[model samples]
Target: MTSAAPVATESGVPLRKPRIGLLGIMQALYDHMIPGITERQSGYAREIADRLADVADWTVGRPVKDRTDAEEVMREFVNADLDGVMVVLLTYGPAMRVARLFNENRLPVLLANIQPEPQVTAAWDMADMTYNQGIHGAQDTANAMVRADRSFEVITDDWRAPEFAERVDRWARSARAITAWKSLKVGIFGYAMNDMGDIRVDENALLRALGPEISFVAPGDLYRGSLEVPGAEVDALIAWENARFEVDPDLTAAEREDHARMQLAIEKILVERGYRAYSTHFDAIGEDGRFRRLPLAAASSLMAKGYGYGAEGDALAAAMVYAGHQLIGEGHFTEMYAMDFPSDSILMSHMGEGNWRVARDDEPVRLIHRELGIGRLEAPPTFLFRYRPGPATLACLVSLGGERFRLVVAEGEVLDAAPLPQLEMPYGQFRPDSGVRACMDGWLAAGGPHHQVLNVGRHAEDWRVFCRSSGIEFVQV
Candidate 1:
């Protein structure tokens, strides 16, 4: 069954429509007698597909007429560049042979085994009423894929049960959700820091599994744009704000003016480049008359409002994008610190950017500051904070969890744990943020790999979908 459209009612986040693929349901009658019913499992399989059609956009049934059927299905999946595919096991015929066909194409396949609810009086009388037909069919399909070293997402909920429709619908929706990830695109600005150089990660590795793409930019480009701000640009900034969130009363006059200018610059870049997501530098200011802010707060705010951002991007941004896509929510930024590190769980959270659409709205959020004396910003120590607004899948662009490239994907919640208490410690507070604690828990418990990235809204899964399309590992949490 296909899932219902994701409604905002489930959360403040909007529902994303997934472009999904459907595998013909087949009745594997290798050992069981063919039902007196006509045409094996063809009609039943189509009905199952019809049920999903009501909720999603899909093309169903690659009837295994021959090896060509598998090839045709694979071709369609690739050409359509679909997000996810649902394979309903009706029979273990040539239909089963096609499971790996799409898997190799990196399409996440959902192994669905659903039987019609309410067995008919004739179902059993027919001498071939096989309730386990659907169940066993899927198991065998999974077996075939596994034999070929393939992995798949399976939904074995009883469709004949009272809540069958709801369960099937939700899975269908989730499958679609995963599909959305396949089309994710991420934007990158600024180069990796030569210092703290250890944070580099392998973006291609993530691209191999995730579907997001990086848009390269120079630090000076943003700085140049900031200095060259114009009146028309300012107006465009307001328009972006309106699209992002409702402007609120809490914003100070100074905040509004600054926001007005910053928003214009960002909007110019995003609109000009056709980017829906981004990751950028936090300390790329200029010397003398020119200066720039890393736009950390801005990144946080936009991501929370449904856009995605990876700070220092590289690989970490991509990882967070994947986690956000998987978790179906925003991913916050996080870092590793021994004392604050979770023996168990930890999540990350941050108040959004001062100029971001979400931040302009001033939704209730905790406010934290940089640890005194940790490191001084060359610019004024103002509200230019680098925070991940929600729990996320942490990642890096460097390799070996170090300088080359690595992505962090996490799943967790926000916590109100107090910030580090006064003590003889490192310059910056060496403790974890309350939000980070919540996220850490999610990462450890969910077994979502840890590190850090910017995942703040419902689109992260789309980022994961992008990862799959791009051939990056979408580690589960």
Candidate 2:
């Protein structure tokens, strides 16, 4: 099952580009340090900050010289709400003070072990050598963080190196994504599909490990809200879908309106609750019979508008989708639907609900009947389309007991799902870079869950950095 065209919903989450702030700090002794050499060292620190501006949105803070100055700089960072802080050490200074400040504030730290000069020149003198030397300072800072049991990253290279700037930008992106996750709200409607142990998560453990808060939404709220939606609103949604997609004539007008009403009600519920993502069990929602319509349209539409939607009450997957979307720009909620050994590919899909934004632009989704009642003629409307083929990554964030989670990721190439006459659902065909048999065996060995978030680009590196920065286990499949 799929969904209708995207709508301009008022409650949609606002997408913001990640911003990274830079801080330059030097450890200088008031009386012992050479004044002229320290001044040149600070100049080098400023240059590093200036170069970083070409890669990311950064604010270079005033260089700190002591513990008191470090605390003050951290205060400024908090006030500015910087995503991550890059500490550029000018000389061997107070590593313990910087580590304490970063730990207390719980900010992601990137230690810039950047040297002022790419290499030692023949004309270099004592002052020039000392000014360019920051390696020991970075080492000291890293040692301090490790002793404090804090997580941090190190980047050591010349400031002028393109690779150096790129690495900094990637860290910035990961940090920004982590910052966004602190206040994530995931709403769970209905119950988890019965007997899916892998999808079941300990709520307290999840909250303690990741900052996202989960809440339950009653089915009655959605059912009543859908019924109360004005006919004009539903008609407007249908008209919007009609203009954008090629709706199959087989679907009755009432079916389309039914989907529209459900979609609008869900949007209102999530918006009113300030939820950025949601999970639901279609079976449980309709079990009472008053609301038999599965929220296929709701799930797909919400995903397109930057909201994560997980089928079968998989709240973890929902949050994972949102995180990937923030870090990767676009992520589709999917599962291993089937294996096509002959084609050396895996058919990935779900019962319904996928990010339509990831669908192929060349092939628009078709309105299809979701015949879930076995032999019933009455069914809801859903979308069916092939996802855009390209390089992609599949990831699953699985729980590993109290306050522990592991990220399972695999890199692959996304291929177009062939249009077989019997295939009626939206899907993306993926060929794992590791080959089908090896990927399948490794995935099963790792106990990867049935559900995952598929992203358009290869983000295994980003995810690895993110997991490390966030203090989660990362297991590559």
Per-residue lDDT tens digits of candidate 1, residues 1-477? Answer: 111111111133454555667766443344345543225455666666566565556766555434567668767876886766777655444435555574465666666666554445654643444533556656666777777665565555654454645444554555554454445556666554456554454555444444445557665566555656765544554455445444444444444445455544564566567565666545333222244223444554455445555544444444344445344444444444443345243323322232122221223232222233211232211233223234433443334432222233444433334434332111112222334555456445443433354433333344443334333454433
Worst 10 residues of 1 by lDDT: 1-10
Write candidate 2's Cα lDDT for 228-295 as tens digits: 78777787788877877778888887788778888888888887788888987867776747765677
Worst 10 residues of 2 by lDDT: 1-10
Question: TM-score per candidate, in order?
Answer: 0.65, 0.92
lDDT of all the models against the reference? 0.47, 0.78
Clash list (residue pairs), candidate 2: 27-93
Mark the regions of model 2 whose C-alpha exceeds 4 Å error after superposition: 1-6, 9-14, 30-50, 374-378
